[model samples]
Target: MFAAAAIAIIITMVLALIRGFIGPTLYDRILAVNMFGTQTVLVIAILGFMMGRPDFLDIALVYALINFVGVIALLKYFKYGSLSIGPGEERNTEKSSHMDKS
Candidate 1:
C-alpha cells in the first residue's frame, strides 16, 4: 500500500500548501510551511521504497535537516529582527523592570 500512502501524503501536502497561503497569521503560515516540508520528506521516503532505491533516504534526511534549520532561522529572524547574536550581547527587547513600562 505504499501507493496509497503516497497519495495520502500528496493530498496532505496540498492542504498544507493551501493553509500556508491562506493562513490568518504569520505563525500559522510558518507552521503550515513546516508541515509541507515534513510531508515532502515523507513523500521522498515513500518514493524511495517504491522504487527500491535506498539512497533517497539519505537525501530525505538531508532535506529534513534543512527544513528544520530553515524554519528555526525564519522564526528567529522574524522575532529578533536579525540572525546575528554576539557573545554577551543582550538582545532582549522586552522591558525587564516593571517601572520601565512604556
Candidate 2:
C-alpha cells in the first residue's frame, strides 16, 4: 500500500513538473511548483512510515514549513516587487507619487 501511494505521488509530481514547465503565466508556474513541493513532503512522510523511521516526520515537517515560506515569498516578490517591507512599500509609494504627478 505504501508503495502504491508513493507511486501515485511520483506520478503527480511528474504532472506538476510538466505544468510548471508549460504554464501560460507566471502564477500558474508558481502554483505548479508549490504543488510539487507539497507532494515531496507527502512522499517523505510516507517513506518514513514505510521504513519505520519516525525521525523522517520531523524532517518532513521542516520541509513543509520551508516550502510554505518559500512559496509565500515568491508570490510576495512577484506582486510587490520585493520581500522586505521597506522596499516593497517604497516601490508602491513611488508608483503612487508618479501617478499623482501625472
Output the number of the TM-score-best candidate.
Answer: 2
User: How many clashing residue pairs, candidate 2?
Assistant: 0
> Which ranges in model 2 have alpha carbons more than 4 Å from their true place?
86-102
Candidate 1 segments whose C-alpha is farther than 4 A from its true place: 86-102
- The lDDT of each candidate is 0.88, 0.88
- lDDT score of model 1? 0.88
Question: Compared with the true structure, what per-residue lDDT tens digits does model 1 show for residues 3-64?
Answer: 99999999999899999989999998999989999999999999999999978999999999
Give the range of the ten consecutive residues with the poorest summed lDDT in model 2.
85-94
TM-score of every model versus the real structure: 0.81, 0.82
Show how many residue pairs clash in every candidate, following the order shown.
0, 0
